[model samples]
Target: MSTQHDAEIDALLGRYFDGLYHSDSSVLRTVFHTDLSYVNGTDGTYETMGLEDYMARIDARTPPASRNDPREEVVERIALKGDRIGIVEARMTMLGRNYQDLLTLINTDEGWRVLTKVFSFVERKD
Candidate 1:
């Protein structure tokens, strides 16, 4: 039973990683809630925004096709408490910089969706 639950969490984590790697806003819409909020490391501040704002950022981001080759690291951890809440951390590498994000997820009637994300620059060892 535990293994099955782990597998489910793993799939959720994968979807989150794939979404960012491909810059697919629709995938993001699936993973994140309508009231999602996040802190932008580049700005060093927290901002509360709707799903549309989040999607806009994804759209504004320089697509992987435009970059040399963006690489997304594996999800380090994904944990769920019962069936209502979860968390995941993933590493991302692009443009000679390393970034990390810790995401908080909430299970809604529809399914698991990210409620918030806290992102930061992990390292820049180029």
Candidate 2:
């Protein structure tokens, strides 16, 4: 069904947002693949992180929720390539930035997992 991707992606995004809001790498580990790669190029520079470094950075950050920072996310689209490959487009705001994310997914034996995340961010208006 067309809505199925929406449901599954929504659930995944929920966890993603929670992990980010709390800066909880443990929570993120559940949803993100161990091989996940995060990329960002909004500043005209190629910035990227592998899961280990990403998790460590997450662990080191101040939890946005603790600072009462606003949490906002909208899943703009979700589509599947056959049944195994998928992609999700989303926008979110956190930690003084607004981000547009392209999340590549794969339906593993373990269910849908984020394989790679390419994102661009701009500083949020205060």
Candidate 3:
């Protein structure tokens, strides 16, 4: 792949973080594949779903951006498995929750798309 691959991943991840913070389904749709699997295993809570349901959940929430929440997000690492597959480790905070996300992506004809997301989050009380 080209050296610009890293930049593409970074830009995609930026959109991911921005989408989550703002609860913008349209933005997120560009980040996640339609058949994407969503896994949440945090503090003994195990939940799994698909992109449509995930979007519904996002739509139901009061967006952090609306509350003037601070965004503390970072991409810890990204590893490419050949030319078509990639894995990313990321961290972020929203709605007083701290999250660690492992995202697996597939490079499609349309570009890189998040195919699966396994994440854990801790609720923060302050």
Instruction: State each model's C-alpha RMSD to the native.
Output: 2.6, 1.5, 1.5
Q: Which candidate is the best by lDDT?
A: 3
Sort by lDDT, top down from the best: 3, 2, 1
Stretches > 4 Å off in candidate 1: 1-4, 41-48, 65-68
Q: 1 or 2, which is superior by lDDT?
A: 2
TM-score: model 2 vs. ground truth: 0.92
How much RMSD separates candidate 1 from the native structure? Answer: 2.6
Which prediction has more favorable TM-score, 2 or 3? 3
Candidate 2 collision pairs: none
Which ten residues in a row are the worst by lDDT in model 3?
A: 1-10
Per-residue lDDT tens digits for candidate 1, residues 1-126, read 374457656676677777777788887788888888877665555455667887998888876645657575767877777778878887778646677889998878877788888787745665
Each candidate's lDDT (Cα)? 0.75, 0.88, 0.91
* Alpha-carbon deviation at 70 in model 2, angstroms: 1.1
TM-scores, one per candidate: 0.79, 0.92, 0.94
Residue-by-residue lDDT tens digits, candidate 2, 22-49: 9999988877988998998787767889
